[model samples]
Target: MAELAKTSEAVHRDYTGAKIGMWLFLFTEILLFGGLFLVYAVYRTKHQADFHTAAAELSVAIGAANTMILLTSSLTMALAIAAIRRSAKTASIVFQSLTILFAVIFLVNKYFEWGAKIGHGLYPNSPELLAQSHGTILFYGLYYVMTGLHALHVLIGIGLLLTMLILTVRDRITNTDFVKLENSGLYWHLVDIVWIYLFPLLYLIT
Candidate 1:
């Protein structure tokens, strides 16, 4: 009995450590994006007209759709964690699957959006973009850099959630030991929150 007690205490300690580690990792991510946001603010202030014109080139409809998709995914991800906590394994799997689907959809939308921009010669280092004013050039440069980074994060989140889904399927993540899923959910939420900020700064800026 003492042995079992010791093992349980060790597991609890591991869980606590894992949670703290994830939070620290998230804090670092926040700092990375926060610095970029500060850079964006400075440039936008210097070239408000260029920023407004550049933002006009982006499609609000597409941006709004992707925002809704990510918001829904966040909801589904939370539901997945909640379902697992309640020991509803099937519901958890369903929600996880839905979250993955939404993520894929988002990427697909981004693909077409990027393709259209590239087709129009808006991509970085392209002759068309190089001809633009200094402010316009800076705006597009920041747009591509920031949004590309955020998209990379989305891809990483998808991979993490996929791993969590597989673990849950294998019963490695269950009601009593689901910190892995919780951590993945937190990462996914960070991705979503970053977009919440990005959508406005990149898409809705006027």
Candidate 2:
């Protein structure tokens, strides 16, 4: 029994190590966005009027819709983890699939929103934006940069969740060895948290 105990301990240690690595990577992501937020705060403070004007141009309805979509996705992701832990493989897959569906919906909304903005010649380096006030230009610039980066993260999260779904189907992520699913859920939640902050800052600023 001593040999079995040693093997079990090693497995637990590896799991703990994996969790630590994920947390550290998440911290780095926080710092990356933290810098952008700092710059935004400074610029917004100095150019509140222009920022408000630019923010008014954004579609609050679409932004709010995307916010709801992502929040629901987070819920579905959490449910997926629970379903897996309960050994309900099919339920877990369904929840994860729902999460991915929500992600795709969010991206579709963003694509249309951005397309409208670009159609109006409001994008960065466009003559329309170049002729705008410095604060307005800065507002749209940050909007695109921040929201675009966040969307990229959403895409990455979709990929991760899809992989988790496949693993669960193959029994590679069974109830007894489901850290991969849990970690993927954690990452999804992190993405949702970032959007929680971003939605208000960009869309509700007026």
Candidate 3:
């Protein structure tokens, strides 16, 4: 009985330590985005009317759908970690795959969104600058900067999920060593949270 208690305590300690480290990492991420947000705020203040006009051109429905997709992925990520810590390898793999699928779906939606916008002359330094309004161009610049950074994060997240998937399938992860899973999931959640702010800001700035 005491042996079992010792094992449980050790596992708890590992999980707790990993979670604390992840939180610290997230703090750094916050500062990274914080600088971007500061820049965005300055731009928005300088061009509120232009930002609103540009935001109006965006598809709010697609932005909302992407938000929900990411939120769902976050939930699956949580379950994946839970399954790993419980030693349910099959369940962990299934949840991890689901999380990846959702991440891909979000990416596809973003691709179409950006492609269509670019097709319509909505990108930084687009040729429309001479013929079109500057406000619209400014909006496109902000959109490109924000969404481009976000897409980079999403790509990183996909890689992280794939790694977790491999580790879960090979039985390399176990109840005693699920710290990596927790760490990756923390990063995944941070991506989702960042999008939560992005969705409303970009889709409904008006």
Error of 1 at 187 (Å): 0.6
lDDT of 1 at 139: 89
Tell me each candidate's RMSD, in Å, in order.
1.8, 2.2, 3.3
lDDT of 1 by residue, 32-118 (tens): 999999999999999999999999999999999999999999999999999999999999999999999999999999999999999
> Any residue pairs clashing in model 1, and if so which?
none
C-alpha local distance difference test of each model: 0.94, 0.92, 0.87
Using lDDT as the measure, what is the rank order of every candidate, best first?
Answer: 1, 2, 3
- The parts of candidate 2 lying over 4 Å away from their true place are 1-13
Q: List, in order, the clash count of every candidate structure.
A: 0, 0, 0
* Global Cα lDDT for candidate 1: 0.94
| Candidate 1 off by > 4 Å | 1-13
The residue pairs found clashing in candidate 2 are none
- The TM-score of predicted model 2 comes to 0.94
Q: Model 3, poorest ten-residue lDDT window? A: 129-138
What is the total number of backbone clashes in candidate 1? 0
What would the TM-score be for candidate 1 when compared with the true structure?
Answer: 0.95
